[model samples]
Target: MTQESSRTPPVQDQAAPVSGEGAQAFTRAQVEELFLNAAREGDADLLTRFLAAGMDPNLRAEKGYTPLILATYNGHAQAAAVLLAHGAQPDLQDEKGATALAGVAFKGDVALARQLLDAGASVDVPNAVGRTPLMFAVMFGREPMARLLLEAGASPTLRDGEGLSAVDLAQRQGNTALAQDIRHAAQG
Candidate 1:
């Protein structure tokens, strides 16, 4: 009996090569803990192993932090990349309703924000306080990130739950330059 000749499948379609009996010994909770730690430590290799083992890239840890949330918030670009590539949900909010983009915004990470945007993160995802990424950037004086978000279609006039817009936050934060920039962008 002849079998089908094409045994080689796409690498990602298969469970990645895991070695040793120890690989099978972890309990689900242990695996969960490892994913969270890997995200926090920026361990891309360990992250890949878990992802290839069919772990949910969006699995939430304590305080409802997903691997993507933890990785990006910690400024782990490579780990965040891996998570996004493995199908992490860019819009998943934590228990506090903060999206990964919202967290990255306050950090002044323009490149990381671009990455998140490229990965389909919404530019205007509001948190529990109804603050969008643009508001966070403006309030934190991340002028460049705020500009990037505006160029990406974040509404400068968007009001948070506290009835403050990005411009309002920028002014309140004492960043007149950013407020001017935001106003100009809005008018244009």
Candidate 2:
């Protein structure tokens, strides 16, 4: 058997003291792992269990990605909605200062983006590099996402750290169609 398969599971013996400090700490770690894993794997049921068990809705993984951000990055709309329902802040940024909306824009998940907007996420928030969600959407040719962000008040005129607006970035990326769309949105 593989080493992982050969390992024994933790005992749930009620006869033993559940309140032991070591046991309690181990259980807490396990619960945290479960919460992080649930977010990464898009396991809504496990996420619900952890949240109901008092796990923080805003808990971040080792890489600083919150449960909502993880779910949004993974395109787990249901899991993301669950996190939002449990008081998770939609605008919380990860280590890179990119929020869940940015991940949704990168992944071209219009539904997730809509959910984030409904939850009051800011469309104009920039990442560490000053690239807003609209810039990401345009650069990545996520036309629908670009439109959504525009509707949500993403400033196409806002420049990134490179001093390029979403239109300029889109044109530089050879996304002429997206550039045109951005221009139209800006003029309207």
Candidate 3:
């Protein structure tokens, strides 16, 4: 896409608005680009407007990244809140089979993870490799996130495609103590 072509079409004219040109109407590509940019930038107000105007909250990008995924992955709590309130599916997976909850756990955004959990996202939701949010958190040394997931009922004993549970992954990442902590937490 050219730089000049990347700009959104004018929302309106000062007086007489052109036909088929306004806030509610847009080409499919323009709508996709607009939503992707808005979500990525955490533009809550813009997202509210787009959603109010009947934009699909779950529209996915070429990589199967929905607006909710982008907003949460980019750490936009308000933007993500708006999308979720507008009916964005919290469990919608990207092309890599990563859900919003799993992404937030990997990114270590506990607040975002809580929001997703409240939105009914599965705590044990897995990626393509069957690595749950707990596994991602433990593997990346996100103790706070791992704790939250464990509290949310994420299965520490669940294994990934490589047969690594949260504890196993922590150990592989050289966090033997973290692995033990995960084990202890799961037990108690």
Candidate number achieving the greatest lDDT relative to the actual structure: 1
Report the number of backbone clashes for model 3: 0
What's the best-to-worst order under TM-score? 1, 3, 2
Per-prediction TM-score: 0.86, 0.84, 0.85
**TM-score of structure candidate 3:** 0.85
By TM-score, who's the top model here?
1
Error of 2 at 170 (Å): 1.0
Q: Per-residue lDDT of 1-188 in model 2, one digit per residue for the tens?
A: 34432222233335432544333323445556667878988988777767776789998787788999988899898898789999999998888889999998998999989999999999999999999999889888898999889988898899999899999988998988888878987898
| Collision pairs in model 2 | none
Candidate 1 lDDT (Cα, whole model)? Answer: 0.85
TM-score of 2: 0.84
| Cα RMSDs, all models | 7.6, 5.8, 5.8
lDDT per residue as tens, model 1, 1-188: 11221111112222343335332234456657777898988999878877886789999898989999899999999999999999999999999899999989999899889999999999998998899999999888888999999999999988999999999998999999889999998898
Query: What stretches of model 1 exceed 4 Å from their correct place?
Result: 1-24
Q: Flag the better candidate by lDDT, 1 or 2.
A: 1
Lowest lDDT block of 10, candidate 2 = 4-13
lDDT values, one for every candidate: 0.85, 0.83, 0.84
Model 3 regions lying over 4 Å from their true place: 1-25
